[model samples]
Target: MFDVKIVNGHILDGTGNPWTKLDIGIINDTIVEIGQLKDAPSKETIDAEGLVVSPGFIDTHVHSDLLCLRPEVHKIKVMQGVTTELFGQDGISVAPVSSETKPIWQKQLKGLNGDIGDWPWESIDDYLSYLEQSDLIGNNTYLVPHGGARTLVMGFEGRKATKEEMTEMRKIVEKGMEEGAVGVSSGLIYPPNIYSDKEELIEICKGAARYDGCFVVHIRNESNKSLEALEEVIDVARITGVRLHVSHFKVAGELNRDKFTKSLQLMDEAREEGIEVTFDQYPYTAGSTVFHSILPPWMHEGGTEKLLERLKDKDVRNRIKEDFLHNEDYENWVRNCGWENIVIASVGSEQNKEAENKNMLKIAELWNTTPEEAAFDLLLEEEANITMIAHWGDEEDLIYGMQHPLQVVGSDGIFGGKPHPRLFGTYPRVLGEFVREKGALTLSEAVRRMTGAPAQLLRLKDRGLLIEGYKADIVVFDPTTVKDRSTYEEPLLEPVGIKYVLVNGLLAVKDEQFTGMTAGRVIRSGVATPVN
Candidate 1:
């Protein structure tokens, strides 16, 4: 008798193989059999008669970096059939921080990761071990953030690293890999990381590559300078012999939207030249991040407190505003999308909570102040503790970019003040709109993007595929009924199609509801799972 039997389903199998009618049986945490299983005895039998069973979605660029600590992790992720996810993305995260650097990271990363009570986060291994030992809902994977590595070795100064400092940074990357990171990641627009020259990044990637890690980057610019940013990462991959992956690759702003094809062709050309590269993207036409990220990089110098001090100084504030006036070197997200399109996604305090889901212009009117003054004061009051979703993408560009073979699915998803609907709707939306409706990709192709492709990148041989010996991480959904219910006005509504999800053979979601089974594991690079 099998522990759990899923019967009469059309299986996609995550391998880009054609859908085949099969029944999958699981015992403990591994699939015991795959084929006809009529009359099979089991503790549970999921009737997947009209469902499409694919491997549970693997979200490769999630900012749920700290959600493993709370029960909400199950609610936000497992309900959407996300059985595994990559955290520590975009180069800023909590691991590898010291007693002194912890405070700085908490402040710098406040927008991405809210404050945490006392938890042992001294090293990347400590953080991973804590998750492994906890009641986590999904398999958690991590990349050593280059932002944290840079801050630890050189502080947040906007200057090139010395040779010795570069060596020290390499050591931090080496130690993070020993702690079991799949790779290293960077946010080039963020502080300290912005200070790193190409030479420094190459050295960082070299260090990560010694442990067979890839470099996942949030490129320097995605708007007007998007092509140039692509060239920079391609250069890193070519020169350092490192595998490269772009996090949420997109061309923003109306001026550069048409260059989308040229940008992707550049990556294709790089592959022809033997530089390995791939990219991830969400289906939505909007993007989310810290509200203060739109400011000139110089404004983020020193640290969050110093930046807050500058924001309060009228002269300094005016000087910074002039950069926006001149359309300076910075990739100002607000200017690219227009201030009215930048809506408040989250806030730091209760008093400011009323501004949640409201745009900057709207918030300004409520405060009886100019939008400029309101933006500055909001940053100062919250210590730049705000996040925003900018409605900045072009539809043709989005569909074109997502259709490329190099593009895989990732939810640059976050949870906080009025989060982007992508957080709740990414996987289902692609299934419903892209595959089921538009026919942009077949079901097998989309499943491979979310599953087999990423599992190959993470070097997980057994998890992503739904073969007999693989781990029992699976999703069952109705192709006809699967649809994303979340929208801009109501962002947190659960998706409608996924009926059941299992994490390591235990039911995490059944009948589209969480089953309170936190049976997920922490996956580290080069760590072997006993497969039979």
Candidate 2:
């Protein structure tokens, strides 16, 4: 008898083709058959009449590293039918830590990646194994974090790596890859990742290249000189022959959103010259990040404690204000988007929870002070753990980027107070609003981008498609009613119309309710490669 039989579903198969009616048979965790199975015996049966059955969504960029450690917290993805989520995004993860820098990274990363308090893994293998031994909700993939390795070797020092240091970091990357990391990631907007120049990046990429792993970068800049930043990464990819993947690709400031067309031209040129380049973007105009990130890079040299000290000093705050108001060289997101555009996504303190989702300008008005003073006061009070959302992109550019062939979807949101709506809404919004509502993409094309395309990028041969013998990672949903209910004002709400989700033949979500199953596996590069 088959383990489970799903009959009468219009199967998309995640191949970018039109839907075809088929019955699917599952034995254990593999899709045993894909054709007629009506007469076949089965232990369980699902009538998928009038519904679409497709491969579960693979989130190309997700920051659920520590959140996944808590079982029910992952319902944010499962409710939307995400089967696989690739972590170690924007260049910071919990693993590959050294004894010296372990405490430092744990605190520094808390601004965006929430606390993991005393969890026991330092090396990549140990970290991945810890998850495997835990109660997981969905399949997870990891990338060797460039910043984590840098912290181990450089300790938040804002300087280019010495040749020996670079070699040491290279070994870490290679070792992580050997132990099953799919790639390496660099968050250039966040330092000391920003400290690395082109040559250093190429060196790191080379290690990932050896294992046929992807080199994913959150590029150095997304504002005024965005094209130049794009060029730098493209050249790095060209020189190293690394499979390049750009994370959460967007021209963030209002001043640069119009330049996205030119940016696309540069990427197209790079691809034409034989660089394997792709990018992921959330379908939102507003972007979320730590509010402290807007300060001058020099102020961040010694990490959050020093930054907090600077925030409290009147003279230091004034000097920073002067430089920000006058400097034309550096791309300051706050200045470019205007104070009115910055909204508080969350704060570290319980008393300030009421400030969640309020814009900086509104807070300033409420406190009877300038936005600059209000911001500094907030940072000083919260100790640099305030997160903000900037309303700063052009709708035209967002649509243009989404229509590109290499574009895949990602939710760059994390768990905490008043997060971005994309945290719970990205996949459903793409399907309902982008596909069914606006017809921006056909159901087949959107499904392909969400599933098959990401699978191809990560070289995950077994999980992205709903073919016979592939892993039974599948989603069943109604095309007519699937839509995201989460909004910026009500960010934590779940989605609607996702009927069921399966991870490796086990139901994780059934009829929009979590099945409370821990069927997730810590997927490794090439299916569990051993470290040398």
- TM-score of predicted model 2? 0.97
Model 1 lDDT vs. the true structure?
A: 0.86
- Per-model TM-score, in order, reads 0.97, 0.97
Span of 10 residues, lowest total lDDT, candidate 1: 523-532
Cα lDDT tens digits, model 2, 98-165, are 78777877777787878768869889999999999998899999899998888888888878889889
lDDT of 1 by residue, 1-532 (tens): 8999999999999989999999999999999899999688888899999899999889999887776667665476888889999988888888888887888888888787766665577799998998888888889889989988888887788889998888888888878887889889999888868778888888888878788788999998888888888899999989878789999988888887766888999999999999889999999989999888878888888878888888878898788778766663667886788889899999989989988899889999999998788889898888898999998888778888878998899998887878889989999999999999998889899999999988887778689889888999999999998888988889989998899999999998889888888898888887322111
TM-score of 1: 0.97
How high is the lDDT of residue 464 in model 1?
Answer: 89
User: Could you tell me the lDDT of residue 523 within candidate 2?
Assistant: 91
**What is candidate 2's CA lDDT for residue 356?**
86
